[model samples]
Target: MRLYVTPASPWVRRVRVCIDELGIGDRFEYVQTRWPHAWGTRTVEMPADFVEATPVVRIPALVADDVTLTDSHSIIDYLDGKFGNHRLLAADGPGRWKAQETNALACAILEAQIMRRAELLRIGADRSDDFIAKMRDRGLRCFAALEKQVPSFGDAFDLAQITTAVACGYDDWRYGPAWREAAPTLTGWYDTVAQRPTMKATEPAETPER
Candidate 1:
């Protein structure tokens, strides 16, 4: 399997952390993407070749002998089912649903943050102020809700733990550590995860575009 991803992407980080945690890191080659630049400066669009390779104009596209999967959640599902030896998601029942629910919330928070960043990059103030504010509020509300729900995990790193950690990390990267003051429980959870070797290995850093 091969994974085309950007190191700074939390979606890619999730997949990388999972691969390392599940001890399948040796199976795949990690390809740092050049398509975003190939498309255009400061644009989300990718070139036709990249699109043909992976329809989603995003990072963490997994390509195997018979499968080419995009989207973080779908990649996770594929990995878990293929490598059932180390199950991150619950095999069945309510626990699986709970994990899925947390994943959904985390993804929503990420999407909001991404949108906010993209809007900031736009050359003009052409976007609706109300829309941006609503997105910001939605992200904050999701973080607050996670703070309440995440405490149940205690000291273990499961799917919920990984997803929430990535979400909080993304917030700190795109927004700032101010979110910590508002959501202490989530702060603690993320701090604990940050110490883990897997999370540390996948941490994002800002860089000038090449």
Candidate 2:
């Protein structure tokens, strides 16, 4: 199996950490990609061959079981089903929905963060204050909501918890500590999660390779 990642993306980090927790790291060939940019430069460029392989040309793609898997959640589903850690998600029911909701919330943080990043990338004259503010507000709401929900996460370390932690880490790395003041509960959660070896190993650089 091959795991292609954009080192700076929390989406990719989610997959990487999942692979680690599943104990399947040995089966995956790690491939680093500089998507939406070329090696620390502002130029947007997906790897030529990767673009040819998938319509979306997104990173954190997995080539396994003789098929290509796109999207972070899809990969999570695959691993949870096969690996059956029993920690990634609930076995079924409203419990599953609760986990899914948390996962979606965490993913939403990244979505807003990515949007803000793209907006920032626009040439100064083209950037819109309204759009940037919208993204920032959206992210802020996500952080606040997740912070309130963190206590319910309890003692078990599951997929939702993992993703929530990744969301905070990504924000800290990409945006800044401004969120810390808003999401204090999540701030405490991240302090512990960041110490996990998987997280330490996959931590995003403050600046991407570009």
Best by TM-score: 2
Clashes of each: 0, 6
lDDT (Cα, tens digit) per residue for candidate 1, span 1-210? 988887667888888888888878999988777533323225455556567668757777888898888878788878877885437888788878877788778888878876776665545566566766777888888888877787466454767778888888888877787678768988886887788889888888652254
Candidate 1: 10-residue stretch with minimal lDDT:
34-43
**Over the stretch 78-101, how does candidate 2's per-residue lDDT look in tens digits?**
877777655688778888898888
Assess each prediction's global lDDT (C-alpha) against the native: 0.76, 0.79
RMSD of each: 2.6, 2.6
After TM-score superposition, the amount by which residue 145's alpha carbon in candidate 1 deviates from its true location, in angstroms, is 0.4
Clashing pairs in 2: 38-210, 39-209, 39-210, 40-209, 40-210, 41-210
Per-candidate TM-scores read: 0.88, 0.89
